[model samples]
Target: MADSDQSSTDSPVDSREDSIQDSKLDKFSEDEETLITMMFNLVGERWSLIAGRIPGRTAEEIKKYWTSKYSSSE
Candidate 1:
């Protein structure tokens, strides 16, 4: 019963997370790269701050983007 309860609550949350990621991927604009870079320089990798500056991106998505685009380890 407890497992069923947990599963019922979790599915919507998982779907919402997936949709947010989809929206970010679909709507990412070329201008966002410049904005993200400038904000990173000012804030130094604080993802929520960067996401607030750029509409339509969650902190998680922005973190992924920044790492993928700018990671020195790559």
Candidate 2:
């Protein structure tokens, strides 16, 4: 019973560590993708313009979403 309790506590911490490592790995994988890099390079800095063109995408709305997203990830 004591062993099971210890394992349970460790399990969540291990899972969290794995998720953090996975996120870093995913970022590295994204860096290797040429097409995605190109699109991000072209449109990332100009969220407003992209938002304007895409239907249902408003500049302010996109800005807020991206801001929250990038902020949380960092």
What's the alpha carbon RMSD for model 2? 9.8
Q: Over 4 Å off in model 2, which ranges? A: 1-40, 72-74
Against the true structure, what is every candidate's RMSD? Answer: 4.3, 9.8
Computed on alpha carbons, the lDDT of every model, listed in order, comes to 0.83, 0.56
- lDDT digits (tens) for residues 7-52 of candidate 2: 8899899999978754543443333334333544787757666555
In model 1, state the lDDT of residue 49.
Answer: 94
Scored against the true structure, residue 55 in model 2 reaches a CA lDDT of 53
Q: Compared to the true structure, candidate 1 yields what TM-score? A: 0.63
Model 2 worst lDDT window (10 residues): 28-37
Q: How many Å off is the CA of 11 in candidate 1?
A: 9.0
Cα deviation of 74 in candidate 1 (Å)?
A: 8.2
lDDT of 2 at 30: 32
C-alpha TM-score for every candidate? 0.63, 0.37
